[model samples]
Target: MDDASDDLPGVMRVVRGHLTETYADLIDVGDLDRRPPQVRDLSFLSRALAAQAVRILTECSAPEAAAAVTDGEGDHGIDAIAVSPNGSDIWFVQAKWSDRGRAVLGEDGALKLVAGLRRLANRHYDGVNVKINRQLTRIDEALSSPRCTVHLVAALAGGGEVTFQAEQRLTRVGQEFGFDGRTPVKVHTLGLADFHTFARLHAAPGPVQITATLTQGWHTVHTPYLAFAGSVPAGEAAAWFEAHGPHLLAPALRNTRSDRIDQAIVEQLVEEPENFWYYSNGVTLMCDSVQAQFFGRRLQGEPARLELGNARLINGARTLAAVAHAVAQHPATAEQALVPLRVICVDNAPEGFLSQLSAMPQSDSHTDLLDQVAADPQQLRIREEFAAELGKQYVFKRGAPPPAPSAGCTVQEAALALACAHRDVSLSAHTSAGLEHLFRPSPAGAYNRLFGQTPPGRQIWAVVQAHRLVQNALADIARTESPWRREVMDHGDLLISHLAFQSIGLEDIEDWVHSAQQDPDWAKQWTGDIVRSLAAAVTDRYGQSVFLASVFTDASKCRVLAEIVSRASATGNQESTANTVAPARRRRNSISVLVDHGRIPDGTRLIYRPGSPPEEAAIGDWLHENPRRYLATWVNDRQRPLIWEADQQAYSPTGLIMHIWREAGWGEAPVAVQGPARWFLPGEGTLADLAGELVRAAALDGGA
Candidate 1:
């Protein structure tokens, strides 16, 4: 005997042939063989089972001719194109085939198929733009049109995995590519089982045999018999009837005494036997009895009372208590009960029970009776009253009697009264709002309003001082013909010279003079003092604003201050000072300072001055104490003093500043003091250490 797996193809072939023949009226010519083998099989089966779909489209609405299969490339991966009979719209079909057994398609495989379709679609469109035209032009242009509808059909030899991911991917792809516009692309999988049912419905013998081997040993066999009066074959009809026909007659047949319904109900009850009784009694009464009698210990009259085999009333109380306890422990089960309650109360009796219970008075005479009993002179007074009402012979009954309410007794009324009390005890809206008001901040709106405006005067003053320094620096550069000055001036020249000089005939020389005067020594000095004052104030106020200290105490800030001081010192002798020449002794001393301090590496010499040590310690100290001033003074002096000698070459003040600043902090000690001289050449410690100690002292003194 051939294996069942081997027989699948034969069975599929028969199903395919039967479907093609049965759906010939609906199938487009030449489409039967055009599809892939698996797809063809699916189309065959889908047509057979989708007879209602065909009737909905064709017979009812008079659909246009069947869509034509087209070999085209488009953004939506449409393999075939079709138009409604009236030319109202167009439809595109993407057919996929797989040999995997009848399992839902996996996410990865579905994604891959979607990707393939996307690639085909991308090739058809020139760009992002989509065009619509009815004319049958080149395949790409036809496919690229926006009016087309794309449908995805997965034809699996058996059902491939139809996962949630696959479904979502199909939906998303259809939306992105405008498959069916607002309607969405229709995605479905067709399997062999479907084909067998379809074949049976449309073209099979009167009786069909379905055989499978059970793992336990015996072979299970099913032979469905059917009577068909239509063009569909008996076998096909039998298969269809087996799968779908039962549902149509199920309701009527289920009402009768049928073994199928009985067996189904038995199986269902076995799975959830509690549901049998739960639904039998009205669900609301069952629920309330559980809450009141079982869990709550406040019994209300039973909504459902059934006669037991022993002729006693089996109230919902015990069951309700048990179910209520179970539900309380497992909240998930509690929520699931709401649906069943709505279903079981189909006649509206539960609603009536709720209404009746809700209408009861909150308090009655029983409350007054209880109060009276509580106020009795003797403890046994209430007991005596109760004993007088009962007969002596009935005192010790086999089963305990149900507890009775005092005086104007009504359990439902009491429960309703308790519920009302609970409602009244809940928090009031005013109390909740008041609690929120307590923790809020004072003047909350003030801070937000302040934040929306400009900063206060002190901050603006600091910014203006910084702007002045930048202006001075630019002005100084404009006055000098040095390469550094030239570079700095070029940017301004480009902007100003373009319109002011060339077109407006403004004199560049006059412009430079006016700009230079605005950046006078007085203005620069004022700005520097203002900035220093602001920085000091901030440091005192905030205490630990290190970022502010770094910016304000920088060498550039010091240099600006130093320039103003130097200019002040040189005022009266302005012309004479400018022409004054430093003696050979001073020059020689300066060179010696550079060498001895190791500003020039060992054995390095300067040609300008080759003798005497230049009060190296004093010069270095002054440089450290007022770096910006020293830099401004050095630049203003015409004597070009070589600062460092490396490779027999002299470095300028600007070059030295760049190198020193790269290694140290703003407003820090001179390079000569902090460099390798003191520590490397037999001193107790380095100049760097001294500088650090001095800075620390200044900081402690609140001077920095």
Candidate 2:
């Protein structure tokens, strides 16, 4: 539905239209056929809504999202389940699509959701129907991981909260699963506004074809392909992005960035249009062919009119998106900007040249490293092995789109898995510091240590899956640990993965798969105890004051920490260490000190990031439904420090945060919060982090 369709009938009409058009083939019809004919469409609509929720929350492609639906009879109230590609997120959706735009999760629905949660949590897949049963193995593995967070998505068609009774039931569920920090179950009530946002994001646009004027144009003739270099008006470039959206980019390059544009690039364009041409890297376009119309003879005198055939912005997609947003927001200022343009005709290009052009711009060390690894004879063999044995796509190219998580993985992902699986904990520790460090060009570097033996494709995939499970399990336990202990658990993800690999003894990589199938809980069962012991052991050895980043980055330090963990686990003395880690000493509040010292620049824009996971879960959906909700500007005043963009009201940071929480319907939110910690300067850390630096600097100077 368009923005103008605000009435109940229009929204419902849109929803109904989608049932037949977008989801007719995808949604399961078996159960709908059994329902009364009058209610069948409504039932389908509800199932469609569940799939939509999966798409929006997990950011999966439509077919994948639709496949997540398990809304037939005996589904236990869960309509769909979607796990993120990285295995960090898991979602369970229960949708209610109402014709009157007044859908509500009533007591019955709430009870059903609760029952489904319990069943899924306790591995009671035997009671679920075949649709859900088919996915029990993957679901079981996801649930067993402590790191993966579960979300209960209540996708209602109405513009209201779930009923009070339903809220109470969900609150009880939250307290049961969420309070423990392990297996945190977040509840999301996605209403009409939220659905509208998701629909907008999910809209698909066709291929883009634009007629552009290129000034001061130059062409190359001796090249294997025809190429033109010129400058295009920023306004024209912006219009292309405005019309085509991500279609402006080549298919493989789309969806690379979360935002429509990079905010920093937008700011630069808007703030310094005259400098844009100098600062920007310009855009590269690949087309089937180009027809240029030039008045008279000289390319320099008159502008050339070009029709770019099947053109795609292969590079600088973010730049074009930034220009579009900037021009929309500040037309007069952004109108002055100019963008350099390069158009290549792929029709006459030599074989393999297109892929070369695509990856040419991304030639950094990591990209180079991946290229080298991909060129290796062993990696080529592994790719074939994966195809022959596992029927998976093994992507190794730098700019190539990654396959779906279930389909396969990229070379970079494989390296990380190998790092974690190495018997030497230092490899995993080095990875925690930076992935490139593993690929450093040395004979004895982590690269040779991991891939030197040319492990089989099955082994690589198995280790990756195991590493994901270990990472998730550690995250779940870390949330409930003491502040110091939690830090170790959070940073020691790869280290724990290494420990699990050593202990599980993957003599055969398929052993992990066999064991996992036999006991899905093996990951959590084995890793949870190890992580707890490791967290305590690290703190005991290094003390709480030790810089965690430094410690994790150093191989020797991580080796010592790993030994301590292994020793503690073997001795059954995990809890023997005295809890000497103290809470951080109180200092002047960062915001107050920053304001009193006149440290922050006035008028600087601030972004509101949720201070905690719970806080994010509480209001993230609400904030996402409207962009203005999370935007604010900093001011000099200590008392009322922020000007919230939504209402243009000046409020103290905490007051603004509370106001947003209340407005978002988080009625049970705590009364007090450290709000400065939630707001951040663009490209800088949180306000608290910024202020803490100043305080630390002053202290180092003896309070001078």
Candidate 3:
């Protein structure tokens, strides 16, 4: 397989670049900072292609796909195994990377994979490696389930299907997995074109091209541009989104938005789909070029075939997302909907015109409330302060990608923290009800009160950090409690945070921040005490039968609870508070054990510093480019803790570290990382250090 003979050189180059960025950790490529994809060995490219196959076919995040790789010693022929989040779907993937852009799975390879599947189905796991062993629990569950569907994926970077004999071998394996006259196993063979398309869409190397039919359409070819105005089937609009996801939007508009707008669009599509065309403002797509194919006269009620190149939906992202959701939930009703659509082909438009077009106000606006505050003098000052004083990224603009939890805070978070830090219980209630209510333009409103005077970035960060600790402590407690108690904890987070913040006197806020950071568990322990005392105060004040969910939102009731809790704290009833709460069951995982024992809580932000000097040099620029990528959300899972914000998916700390390394073009990422050691808890030491401390303490207690 020679690169010179490759039929898809352009596509291959793009896919190879993406594969390298996503799967560099799968191989050891020496101490080079980066290397050309062509120069990489066949094994590295092939393994990356296999991981890409798992990622694309299973729709798992890059880290999850990488974690699925089981291609090493004693792998039998299986390259990777992808199990769905719910364990209801699984894919056993084998792939080949062909430099000449063609790979065909021979009969021997197919048979070997089938044999591996058979061994897995029969629960024979004698010789498998740790990777396969780790996944055995999920694989067994998926195999035993009657409803689960297993897929054998033969993915290649070349242009051809599996050999006929290989296909036959797969069919026989499928029959063996069948039960109750239903075949649970299926086969999927992907070639070069499929990989190319996936790379284009998912990697977002360029603007996505979409072909759609516009009904009852009329086109106008002006001097510089072409425009088409018509009605598009809601189904077609959704299909575009389904195929391309966020790539349908202009580059600048790809950030996550408030769900309120999305919900409104869904409600319309589900309830009054037929009138959607009239009630909703239509979508506008900007294209670099357009090719229109029509059967009859272009203007005389015939559907126009549109092949748009470099297409971007400049407006109506919410509508598109909502329609897609509605179609999935209630397909029959949603497909009946017609949406007004306009496609503008600005083939020779002047520079910055498309940007201007995208920036134009639309009839149906999905603007975030924070966008209004972005230009405010006070907010701008705060943003600058955060960057200058704390060396943190403070994002105030809507549609701007937020900084990572450890790196910075958003205006919304700052406002909420400030509100909770305020002594007024009503401010907490206002914040809990809806963030938008607090953003009202009235100078005398919550917005002014929270940000009227410039607050120090350190103070804001301290409050936000403490609030996060409180949240984690509460979530840990919630997991062990009954449904009602859990709901109260969930719904009353802001109120509880307010109580905790108020309990820490104004003069001691900085001192508490320093102490808590130095001894991370101290914050959790104190929060747990406050929570227990607050629960008691609530029970004593409103009786056990009272609905706490309703009580937390009412300012007057919260004030009373605050009084009771404060009085108990002031009278030194800390021992009684600790005695009131029940003990939690011990968990095995160190992270989970920490949470269960009230040492660390969920929602804690962990800093992911590079483990090695070589690694730091590789990824430092990438992290500097986007600071949010430096932080990962912590969860109390047995194996994985860090949740990646890019896809809102969970990844083991080391897996996430590998992913970051790969993404940063680190050619020589290590096979293993001291995951806990790399994740630091602010002023406290690494998670590895913290866990060791807990272990030593437990040993001391046991000896005692």
Q: Which candidate wins on TM-score?
A: 2
| Residues 330-354, model 2: lDDT tens digits | 9885459888788888887776787
Predicted candidate 3 versus true structure: per-residue lDDT over 1-704, tens digit per residue: 24443355788887777776677665433422265545545667777777888876766677778888887667888988878765657789888888777778989989999888878865679999777899999998766543356788998887757888998898876435422123446788888887777877675466789986877645555655678777788888889989987667775564322222344467777888888887677788999888888867756458778899999988877777788888888888546999888889887888798768877554343254466677688678878878886899888888789899999988878878877877667778655545664664432136655664455566687788867767877877776765545545665788888887777643345556666666655566777677777767766665544434345545676777778877777778854432222223323444655555666678988888875565677678889898788888888775567797666778876567757866777643432344666888898888868877888788999999
Clashes by residue pair, model 3? 101-158, 404-628
Candidate 1 per-residue C-alpha lDDT over 78-145 given as tens digits, one digit per residue, 9 for 90 to 100: 33444333332334333333333443556765675576455444442342212112324443332333
Instruction: Candidate 1: list runs displaced more than 4 Å.
Output: 1-11, 20-68, 71-76, 80-92, 98-152, 163-168, 174-186, 202-704
Q: What ordering of candidates by TM-score runs from best to worst?
A: 2, 3, 1
- Name the 10 consecutive residues with the lowest summed lDDT in model 3: 578-587
- At residue 175, what lDDT does model 3 achieve? 39
RMSD of each predicted structure: 34.4, 21.1, 23.3
Quick one: RMSD of model 2?
21.1
Per-residue lDDT of 297 in model 2: 74
**Residue runs of model 2 more than 4 Å from their true location after superposition:** 1-8, 32-34, 52-65, 73-76, 83-91, 104-126, 140-154, 159-204, 209-224, 228-246, 249-368, 372-493, 497-532, 535-704
lDDT (C-alpha, whole model) for all candidates: 0.31, 0.70, 0.71
Q: Kindly indicate the candidate among 2 and 3 with the higher TM-score.
A: 2
Q: State model 3's lDDT.
A: 0.71
Alpha carbon deviation, residue 200, candidate 2 (Å): 11
